[model samples]
Target chain A: MSKGVAITGMGIISAIGNNVAENYQSLIDGKKGITRVEKIDTIHKDVIMVGEIDITNEAFEKKLGLAKDNNYSRTAFLGAVAAKQAIADAGITNINKYKTGLISATSVGGMDRTETHYYNYLTEAEPRKYIDGHHAGDSSQKIAEQLGIEKSLVTTISTACSSAANAIMFGARLIKSGQLDRVVVGGTDCMSKFTINGFKTLMILSDTYNTPFDENRKGLNLGEAAAFLVLESDAVVKAENKTVLAYVKGYANANDAHHQTASSDHGDGATLAMEKALKVAGLEPKDIDYINAHGTATGNNDLSEGRAIIRVFGDNVPDFSSTKAYTGHTLAAAGGIEAVYSVLALQNNIIYPNLNFKTQMKEFNITPQLTLKEKHLDVIMSNSFGFGGNCSTVIFSKEA
Target chain B: MKKVYINSVCAITPQKTFDNTQFLEELIEYDANVINVVNPVYKDFIPPAAARRMAKGIKMGVVASKLALKESGLENVDAIITGTGMGCVRDSEKFVSAIIDNDEQFLTPTAFIQSTHNTVGGQIALELGCKGYNFTYVHSGISFESALLDAKMQLELDEAKAILVGGVDELGDHTVAIHKLVNHIKSENINSNALLESKTQGCVFGEGAGFFVLKNEKQESSYAEVVALNTYNTLDEESVNEEAIRFLEENNIEASSIDAIILGNNGDVNFDGYYNKLTSKTFKDIQQIYYKHISGEFNTASSFGLWLGARIIKSQILPEAVKLNITETSKFKTILLYNQYRGKNHSFTILKQC
Candidate 1:
């Protein structure tokens, strides 16, 4: 049997907090990060709330010690900050010591700058630096450079909200196949007029705080953040004597093949992803103690993911909840954010509360965990479904 | 370990490249800043009802993938992976402009749904009804290389026997306008034959889709063997040569062993130096080739380079239009394709004759 990949360290910077410790504290203290928008000068600032990080672009630039002329986008800056923290937490001072690769996921790479300087490029020569950084891979490239990774397998995945989860899944596969000794896998996304307006056009942006698994649920609140994890091969873990936080036991990616954006009426993709993950981990549904659902509180996602959960676990459903209400929907960063939450759940044996839940979903009898509960958790499953009908499930366990 | 071989290849680029039997017999000359692909009869491959909702990128991707699968003589594969830099830009622009124009009210889900980066892969799966592993990578120029790496890993690990992989992108109005504003697109137009000599600034922006069917077992239609693929997010022009050498060395081959090298030259005065350094230095004596002059430049244009490489290896003939130097090999045994976009997302792919 194949041993699980070891998650030696993790780091995250979101609307809630700057690091893992702070994020965990915020979750325990029941602090929801949703608030009025302050970063982007959007016309809908008064109409829609967001989980915007309080840090300014100047602050991020200062934190990275970059020159003023450097063209690091806000998305790349947040990604570099979070990825650096993850590398430090993993105690990996020399990134090239082993065959290491970096897989960073982001839906918005440098659009914040592009949108800001959209019309300035022709007249102003100074803003031309950002033009080269507008592609989705530019953010990942910046983070890789900051981490001192060169001439290695550095790539980016953008599958909407499931991008980071797929990055983690690919990182684990690389390690398991002996292609890389160590890998940094996660995702980062900064708020942009592109996404904010995009979601608004879909009519999925809730004006108020989202309520997941509730009959009166409206939609999701957009958010911005970055999260990363250091996944190491078993050989590296044994050699370094690393403190294994949790094992990436299993991961599966399945497509709905139903519609471009909408989930299938029966949630076929979600069910397949969960089933495949359980099989890969050599575990049963009953063994899972908690589930970090992809409940964006949007009408489509909640109902589809809820039905998938019910179908996979049958009557023995675990204590599942969505922390999206706290952090809002971070798009590509959603998977990484929840991944950190899952690892923390295993470490603390505490299931996070699914904030702002008043009633059960009308479509099914499934109900999310509303209040934080202390329990001896061994295995936790996390789900992330995205546009393009992409569905992914990742299982994190205490033991490999 | 299962050895994955490329069974078939299909490409829809600015040049007449869709028909694998012909090699750039006719090319579309564009004087404008933006270059659109020489479109095929997409209706023949996709139904009108289903094609109505697809963006140009999705349509190109779906048709290219279907053509590739049909050429490979396979009904479906166990997995599908795709790469795109600017994914469904038309829809993205539509959604963004609608939100701005309509004051963020009265919006629908079609454009927003199609704007996701993985729409191409998801659409292919939906059309084939193949519920298997699917993934989409959207890293700049390395996007397609990332997909290739993923497909290679799965094939070697025995996870799947057959897989479909492709890279696609389409030009959007706002994106092109912003890119022009930033001078990422060429300011002065140049002839396709003189792109290298008239290197002024910025690349000639174009869009296309290229697809390939890879299987563990080699068949009669197999074109080439995927030896190795590697990508670098950032590599200085000074280090590209060393990196390429190291990649080949690690694969138990040498630069001299490569029968031909396909270079991605987009006429960008600032970044084309990277490719020039290669063609003028260690690769000077080797049979050299280039394609961006005809295909134009886009994020996934390297997939066109890969298509050219695979065809060269299979057909064992170098098209005169693609030849960069007079030195020619009698037999095309091994081919190396190097691609980069504006000095980012550098990738090296090596294909061997099966």
Candidate 2:
């Protein structure tokens, strides 16, 4: 297999931690960030638990040093923060030195602010500034401006929960195809009344800590967070002598086509995504060290993903776990944070425990890694499935 | 690199462009600031039960994709990629209003589920049972171009045989009202025929869907060869001319060789200067074409521009309604498209006769 796109740096901000080191520490200590909603005002606050970050909109604005009257939304704030961290971690002082681009993912662009000033925009002039930030691309544009990236290939992707995975996939393809020498890719989403009420209507918002792969798994806890990864082409890596964290080995996206919001009983789309991703990586199931499962803890997702995992790995499934228990299901950012976690696992030669796994799932005999285990790791496979039957799998390896 | 071909194209625009047999044969004149698609009989394309729940954006996308697929003589493509600026805005507005007006009580999932940006792409996949690669781009004006670029890359690499790509956006009442307050929509209603002449602060807002089937293999029905495409997040007015020249040179084409240039002049005086730089200097001598007059203006309105480009290449006819300049070419072989919105997300796409 050829050398894949090199991941020079990664940064993330989730309920579990504000940076990579903090998140890794929490993972090893078996700490979770799930709690009651604190940021957004919602009627379901008592009935729904979320992995909400502690930072306030004002605090973020202050940190970014924006003007007092700036119209930055929570989504844009989180995305800019995470993307800036990624750029800084990459040790690149000049952003436009090479042909660079940004690909961001977000399901809720500026809805947090939109929903807040929905009616106020008509009567109040102060809140009307947010009307320009309502589109899903506005956050990406803001992030790009924050990074000083100009007149380049900057775009946004929104494929529901699998959005960030597709963003990373597209970024990898861009580098592999020589479209850009460097690219920053990931996703961000802030908690909003729109999402909380939306999931509530679907009856998928768990009122307690999410339990992944449990027979009595309640449901997924919605979260708000952002994460970004910096991918560099092989030429840039060699010329700059950059420290390679890991290589994006393979990625694939497939549609379940079974339902609008539900996965098929057999996880046909998930199975195909995994199988195709492995093929692209030129690796076999036996070669994978760990599997970062898309165990959203939702009744439909866990079962469907579990079955797809079994279908791909057969009897000898690799040790796998879901980090959602620590950060909840962060919607668009789930794939991005999980990717960071997968890279951390490969670098440390460790497999994170599926934090809230309890009873074994009855449908399958397989179970997730229940405790932290250190092993010689090389390749890891990560799965992210979302609404609209969008399923994606991305493989990372220590060796290109 | 393999050549990517636009095998078939279909669009449901403000004009009567849905029927592939007709190419802008008749234009619908609208005197409103906010215009809607000249909708086809959606029931003829979708089942009543499924059609009832689908928002206008979804219906337009689904019908356009089906028609494009039918014209390509394929039951399903290997992947479905879509782009939208404000995806299912109607549903999103409904859900948000219900959350606020109802005090978050007794709401259903239909509106919320359909509010996602990928709902249209997902619905098209469901209708075709296409369990392959799927993606959705939502980057304002570049949304459709982003999707087109993704499909171009995959087809060039021979990763997929055929891909279905489209862009669709629907106007929401709340969204229109908000945009009007921000001056993104025209303050006064103007005749569609006088869009460019209006010289107003904002163009008339409109909504529609445009879909195309792209494949690596050229067929008898192929409309045009997708030569090259590029997008920029930001550009100065002065740099647009230089950027256009550089883009064409990088593709090994010259300005003199371009048969026609399709400019997205939506009559927004504040931002149309980006196109004016090219029309007044770089591409002044080439055949000039404009479509926003008939299609109105939206984020994905450039997709309609692309449809016109591909249709002209296939039929070798430049409708009198879309011509912007007197310069005429004996053969419509190469065409260039330039588009931007609100002075950002600039893009250029080149199409050639196959």
Q: Score the docking of each candidate (DockQ).
A: 0.66, 0.92
lDDT (0-100) at residue A9 of candidate 2? 92
DockQ of 2: 0.92
Best by DockQ: 2
What's the TM-score of every candidate structure? 0.96, 0.99
Looking at model 2, the pairs that clash are none
Which digits, one per residue and each the tens of the lDDT, describe model 2 over residues B1-354? 899999999999988899999988777888989988899999999999889979999999999999999999999999999999999999999999999999999999999999999999999999999999999999999999999999999999999999999999999999999899988899999887788888889889999999999999999999999999999999999999999999999999999999999999989989998888998997988899999888888889999999999999999999999999897486899999999999999999999999
Cα RMSDs, all models:
1.9, 0.8
Instruction: Please provide, for model 1 over A76-118, each residue's C-alpha lDDT reduced to its tens digit, 9 standing for 90 to 100.
Output: 9989999999999999988998888899999888878877766
lDDT of 2 by residue, A299-339 (tens): 99989999999999999999999999999999998899999
List candidate 2 segments past 4 Å from native: none
> Mind sharing the TM-score for model 1?
0.96
Residue A63, model 1, lDDT = 91
